[model samples]
Target: MLEPEHGLIRQVEHAHTKCWVCVLSCLLLASVYVGSLYVWRSSLPRDHPSVIKRRCASVLLVSALSPAAVKAWIHWADIRVDVSVWELMGVRLEGFVPALILPLLLTMVFYLGPLVHSAMDDPDGFTTELQSVLDVQSWRLCVRDVVWLRNQVVAPVTEELVFRGGMLPMLVPCAGPTAAIFVAPLFFGVAHLHHIIEQQRLQRDGMSVILLVAGMQFLYTTVFGAFTAFIFMRTGHIVGPVLCHSFCNSQGLPDIGFALQHRERTALLFSYLMGALLFLVLLFPLTDPFFYGAIPVCSLAPAPEPVC
Candidate 1:
């Protein structure tokens, strides 16, 4: 078999234009995610499932739209580079399992852990507030509708294209992995800062809450972005971190500050164990070489030198 570097280089060279197109397509998809919500809000039914479906549809729409948008946009916008349908399928398909399945497993384990904690206090107030924040029927309903759409579909697609596909590749060769990981999330946080601002402005009926909700959302999303960036570096696939992130977010896990303070306690050990296990689900492929081999991602080799 030919060396992998031979294939990697050809892959990069052939797909370079499509890569840029993916990055640009993210911006368009984000607009769609936000815009569709605004345009359809009044028309959407107030029932839990309907509300959740519309929101989830928006997210899935963004995920599904990125590649198609990129293909059309690149064909018209960049005449210098050519991209084949196979390459498009390769990139998107490479993303599917990690983006979808892994997160679901992690969330299941994460919630189950808390349920086992005898001292684990249910935040009914937070739960009620969260349901209102999502404008959905129930927690389970929101999970099926909003989270499945946003994290699994929209967030992974848009975020991976911008960070791993666009920003990381541009910086990794020049600044190396450490720098790329750090820098990428800073920009990712910046990209989604508007979410924080929007959440703060949201007032549902008479339930006026403090501005902390916005701050929390910003902090949470940024933290998620940082973790996702690291996963992409470790696994050489944007899918890994995207799965890791969606899992972490959907479970409504506590922040690092709380996790650390409780790290040494035995009573709270189950929660930590569950959270750790959830994190491991995202790392499954990396830990299992056989599984890694099954996925179509860039090799973990240093970039091959250009032939003179």
Candidate 2:
């Protein structure tokens, strides 16, 4: 019944609003999610099939329990907004079509170089790749790959659900939409710090290098987390962020250096630059709530602001 607030106080109107409470809740949620992965003791490497599957189960359990944060908010915050926890987390059916397409398209725009390079580098050509994609058998192969499934499917769904979907609602109540977009992702980035332990255990690199790589990964995930959070708030739909997250996972990071050194460097560079430009230009318009329906995110905020 009691939601404690501690740490830096963030100003907000109303009899009581606790951004710090939401933040601490997020930290606890993220810690549990990350800590769950290590509960299954195994000498096997992180990538081992058994280890990966067990960790997957652990994370999923934590992810499933994450909605408790929202439930706690509903009870203690005495929230004024008219919204169900499901709608606040963007689980509703409305605006789904745009959610399913627009976010993914906008994300693809960010990786145009890699996409083109991947197609051109295909020895058998784009048609073969297209056919493979269309082939149900290839999909079966994909399903069989545990690591691929973890990355492209389970990770995206659970992560967006818990990190962006669950956390953002709590955050927006006190942080405001813009601040929520930036703040919620910090927990996401911190959750990834567990990777340092895995890499260090494997001794794949020196401690400094491992730390550096972990730092870079943290940066990447945090930035990507912010993007997903933005779209989630904008479209007021979790499906859009989930789709975008999965697509980004499949694409991985685009290698600007590789594009610069590619044999067809000119075209690749152009595509890369243009893709960045297009993504920036289309970011707001594509995610405009006008296309997605009413700003369901408003349901999460305590009071309507320009953000809603």
Give all TM-scores, in the order shown: 0.51, 0.91
Provide the overall lDDT of each model, using Cα atoms, as 2-decimal numbers: 0.50, 0.83
The sequence of per-residue lDDT tens digits that candidate 1 reaches over residues 119-234 is 34556755665457667465466456654666555566656654455454443433445655565565566555554434444444232343355456567666666666655554
User: What lDDT tens digits, residue by residue, belong to model 2 across residues 1-308?
Assistant: 23333222222333345655677778777887888888998879987899889989988888777777778866666665676777888888888888899999999898887888887688576667678888999999999999998998889988998898788887887878888899998999989998888888888899999989989999999999999998998998999888888888877899888878788999988888899999999999999888877776676665676555
Model 2, residue 263: C-alpha shift (Å) = 2.0
lDDT of 1: 0.50
Task: Find the 10 residues in a row with the least total lDDT in model 2.
Answer: 1-10
Clashing pairs for predicted structure model 2, backbone only: none
**TM-score of predicted model 1?**
0.51
